[model samples]
Target: MSQTIAVLDFGSQYTQVIARRIRECNIYSRIFPYSVTAAELRKANVSGIILSGGPSSVLTKGSPRPDKKIFQLGVPVLGICYGLQLMGKLLGGDVAKSDRREYGRGRLTIKKKGRLLKGLPKSIKVWNSHGDKVTALPEGFEPIAGTENSDYAVIEDATRNFYGLQFHPEVVHSERGDDIIKNFLVGVCKCKQDWKMSNYVDQAIQDIRDQVGDSRVILGLSGGVDSSVAAALIHRAIGDQLTCVFVDNGLLRLRERDRVEQVFRDHFHVDLRVAKSGKRFLKALKGVTDPERKRKIIGKIFVDVFEDTVKKIGDVDFLAQGTLYPDVIESVAIDGNPAALIKSHHNVGGLPKRMKLKLLEPFRELFKDEVRALGKELGLPDEMIWRHPFPGPGLGVRVMGEIKKSYLDTLREADAILLEEMKRTGYYSKVWQAFCVFLPVQTVGVMGDERTYDYVIALRVVESVDAMTADWAHIPHDILQIISNRIINEVKGVNRVVLDISSKPPSTIEWE
Candidate 1:
C-alpha cells in the first residue's frame, strides 16, 4: 500500500480539497467514509488522520462520526469544521447551534502557542462555513485559536496528538491554512513530505499490477487528459495486457480523432483499438436540440459502443477510466447539502450499470492540475498536458441548436483559428481554458455590395483553479480584435464575433 494520510470523510464538499491540499504539501492522502473502522484504516497503513468537515450537525442523529478507537491509535489527528464539532462532542466537549452563525471569511486569533499554529501570525484570515460552534472545550484539551464569533475556534490535545479547527484552512480563503496543515504534519505528526507526481506514478503502477494480476483491462480513450492519463498509467503497469479503445464520436475537435489514434498507437506505443462510430453517435443525436437530451443520448451511445468493443475484445475483467476528482465531487451532494449538478461528464455519468467487468479509477482522487503533473511524470507530451478542457459531448454542445456536419465544421475552423492566434500571441498558456461557441442565431452583414446572413461565434476564456468556479480572462482588446477579424474573414458562415463576459456561476465554462 502507498504511504498515506487517511481522511475520514463526513461528506463535506471540501473533503477532497483537504486531501488535495495534503498532497500539495508532498504527502499522500486518501479519503474514506466516516463509518470506516480503525481496523480498516490500520490496514491502509495510515500515517496520519484527518476528520473532514461535513454538512450535518453533530447533534443530529444518524450524522456520520468516526470510530472512537481513532483517538487511541497513537497517530496524529486533525479535524476541520464539522469534524471539529464531532471531535468536541466525542471527547466530552459541548456543541450547540450557534445563535450567531459564522460563514465566509473570518479572523482566527491564536490565543495560545501550539504546533498547529506555529510559524503563523498572531491572527490570520480563515474561510468558515458552519452553523454550529463548540460551546465548551473537551477535558484535557485547550483552545489554541478563536475568532470573534467562535470562542472555541481551534482546540487541541497535545498529549493525544489531536488538533481541531472550526474554520476551513483547506480553501484558498484561509491564507495560512496550508501553513497550519504543514506544521501539524511535520512538527506534530512527523510525516515526511515525500509525495510527488513521480512517486504517485511509481506507486500507482505497482498498485495496478498487484490489483490486476494477469487480468486484462480495457480502457476507453476519449483523447481528453483524464482517459489519456488513465490509459497511460494502466499501460505502464500491465503493458500488452491493457488494450485502449479510442472511439471517434465525430464530435471531437477538428482532426482530433486521428491525432488521438496516432498519439496512442504510434507515438506512445500503447496497444490501441480505433473504432469509428461517428455515424452512430450522430444518428442517435439526430434532431436532438435540447442540451441535456443531447448529452444523455451521446452518453448512452458511447457506453453502448464501448461495451460492445469490450465484449468483442474478450477476456477483459477490468474496465479502466480517467475519472477525476471534480467529476466525483460534483456528482454527489456533500454532507447531504445540495450542490449544483454541473454537466455530467461522459466517462463518469455514462457508465453502464451491472457491467461484467470491475472498475479501475486511478485518478479518482487527483485534481485537474495534479492529473497533468502525473501525465508529465508518465512521459506524456507537454501539448497533451496543457490541452484545454473539452466537454465529453464535444462539439455537439459547442453548437447550440442542431447537430450537423456543416455547423460542426464551421465551429471547428473558428475554434482552431481562435486557439492558433492565442498560441501565436503566447496567451494560450496564460489562460486556463479557451474555446469558441457557435451561436445558433445568424446576423446580416455586408461585404462590398452583398448582404449575407451567417452564424455568429462567441469566444470564451477563463482563469480558474478548479473548473468549479472561474473568472473571465482579461485579454487585450487588440488580441480579441485580431481573433474576431480572422474568424470572420477566414471562417465562412460566421459574420459576427462576441466575447463571453460571464463567469462560472452564471455561465458554465462550456456554452451548453
Candidate 2:
C-alpha cells in the first residue's frame, strides 16, 4: 500500500523473479515496460528502480531502452545484464562485444567497497548471462567488482546512487543474490518491510468492487488454486454478481469435476453451472497429435464452448480468469521479443474473434504461492489450497502424441494410482507436481514367464518452491518401488512404469 519499487521489464524472462525476490524481503515491487517514463514512475511514488535483464544487445537497432530522464529521478537505480549495457551506452560509458560470452555461474571479486555491495564478501559467485560487457565507466563512476574475464563487472556512482551489474543477482543460482536485493531495497531505498499477502485481501476486494461496480462477471473455474482463489475474491467483492462455469472436457483427473462442483456450488453459494461437453472435446481432439496444434485446438474449442455458456447466462459485463503472474509473463512477449514463448496461456491465447465483454484477471500480478496464501485468507480448505497445479489443456498435453479415449483412460487410471501411492507414502505434499504421462509406445515385459506387451506410463515428480524452476524429487527408493509396482499391476493398460529424473532447464515438468 505504501511506496513500492519499480522493476522495468525489457523482455527478460527473469523479470518476475526479481519482483518475487523483492516481495520475499517484505518490500513491495511492481513491473513495467521499458517504455515507462520517469514522470509515470514518479507519479506512482516509486521508492527505488530496478532495470531487469533482457535477451537483447544495446547495439542492436530497435532494442528496448528506458527513458533518459530516469537517471535524474533522485532514486537508486540498479542495472542488470543488458540493463548494464544500456546504462553504459546512454551514460557515456563504453560497452563492447566480448570475444568470449560469459554465461551460467561465475565468481565476482569486489574491486571497491561500495554501498551496494557493502556487506558482501570480497568474492562471491554470481549468475552471468551476457554476450557484451562494460569496457569502461562513465564520469563519476567507479568499478566495484569484477569476474575473471569481465573487468568492469560491477560499476557504481555513490553520489547519485546508480549501480550496475553484469551478472543477474535476482536468480537463486547467484550466491548472495537475496542480500544484494535487500541492501538495495532496504538500505538504499528506505522501504519498510511491511508488505504481506494477508494485507492484499482488503485492498484487492475494494479494487474489484470499484472496477466491477454493478456489472455481471463470469469466471471459468478449473478447480486449480489460482482460479478458485480468484473466484473467491471476486465473489466476496460482488456477492451475487459473479457466476461460474466449470467445464468437464473428459480430460481431468479422477473425481475432479464432482469435487470442484461441490466445493464451489454447494459450499461457497456461488451461482455455478456445469457444461457437459466432454464428448465434443474428445471428438475435436480425436486425431490431433502435435503439441502446439493440440493446444491451439483446445484453446479455440474452449473459447467457443465458453462463449456459448456465457450466451445462456445472459447479459455479462466481464470475463474473469484465474491467471497468475507467470502466465502473464510467458504468454505475451515483453516488447515483442523472441525466445519468450515458454507456453501459451489458455485464457489469453485462447480468445477467438471480437467480444463485447471486457476481460478481468485479478490474480495476474500474484505468484502461485501468493494466490494460495490469499485462498487461505479467504477461508479455503487446506486440502484445496495445497493441491498441485493442473494445466489448462488438462490431460491432453500429458497424453503424448496422438489423442484417443483409450489413452486418456489409461493415463487417468495410472495417474490415480500414482497419486494414491504418493499420498499413502506421505510425499504428495512434498512434491510440486506428480502425474502420469501416457507414452504412446509399448514395451515387452515378463509376467510369470509369459510375454506381455502393453502401453508404458512415465511418472513425473518434481520438487520446487515455484513451478518456474524445479528439480526431480528424490523420493525414498522403497516408496517409489511401491508406486511403480501399483501403477503397473493395478492399471490394466499400463504394463511398464518409468520415472522421469530430469530437472526444469533440460526437461519441463510436463512430458509434452
C-alpha lDDT of all candidate models, in order:
0.85, 0.86
- Tens-place lDDT per residue, model 1, 1-512, is 45689988787778889998888888888878788889988888888899988778888987877899988887989989998998999999899999988989999888887888888989899999999999988888999889989878999999898889999988888988899988877888788887777888888899899889999998888788878888888988998999998888888888898888778778778878888999998888878898878878887887788788987888888888887777766664433333346556666643566566777889877788888888988888888888877877889889997888888899999999999999999899998899999888989998778999998999989998877678999999999999999999999888899999999767778877
Q: Pick the candidate with the highest TM-score.
A: 2
lDDT of 2 by residue, 1-512 (tens): 66789999887888888998998998778888888989999998899999989988998888888999999999999998988888888999888899899989889999786667878889999999999988888888888889987988888888988889899999888989899889888888889999987767887898798888999999888898888888889999998999999989888888889898889977789999999898989999888888888887887777778789988999988889887777766675634443367777676643544656677888766778888888999999898899898998899999999889899898898899888888887899988889999998998887778888989999899998767888999988998888889888888867898889999887777776
| Model 2 regions more than 4 Å off | 332-339, 448-450
How much does candidate 1 score in TM-score? 0.93
lDDT of 1 at 398: 91
Q: Which ten residues in a row have the lowest lDDT in candidate 1?
A: 331-340
Model 2 TM-score? Answer: 0.96
